[model samples]
Target: MQFLLDSADRQRLSLDARPDGALTLVFDEATGEQASVAPRTLLWYKLACTLPAKLPPAIVRDYATKTFKPAQAYGALLNTLGPCR
Candidate 1:
């Protein structure tokens, strides 16, 4: 998976996910402002991006049939982004 985020600050960030389980995030090319997160961390990043959609309790219960919404899982998901790297 890949995506481009154009910030209001006029910055273009290129994000790429590879089949080999690696995610590359590039901020700039001239100054080499870039970083790459491990495959697992990348997965968490993807989940975090969609967290808002699962924030509603009704939606969570309807789809997952779980009483609790996953919004509370945000912290644990975010924590996975670190240490695992």
Candidate 2:
């Protein structure tokens, strides 16, 4: 399962992979340590960006809701960002 973030601007984008099978966040442009985020945490990042305002509020109530892990899914979300890093 991969995740893709499609916004109005395509250039300002990124790609990441969880080779170890652990959820990981890969920024399109390496921002040092800041770019690497936990697989589950990346879900939060995605939600904060795309989901409806109401959805986030509800999600906050239960921090463990539908959190996808990198291990569970291979190089997912990589294609979304374009190429792998």
Among these predicted structures, which one has the highest TM-score? 1
The TM-score of predicted model 1 comes to 0.40
Model 1, span 1-85: residue lDDT tens: 4546565589887765565555567788688787876545654455445433324566445644255434444333344343332
lDDT of each: 0.53, 0.39
Local error of candidate 2 at 21, Å? Answer: 2.4
Clashes of each: 0, 5
User: Model 1: residues >4 Å from true position, as ranges?
Assistant: 39-47, 50-85
lDDT string for model 2 (6-44, tens) is: 446763433344555333334454564324444345554
Q: Per the 3 Å backbone cut-off, how many clashing residue pairs does candidate 1 have?
A: 0
Q: Which candidate number maximizes lDDT?
A: 1
> Candidate 2 at residue 81, lDDT?
30
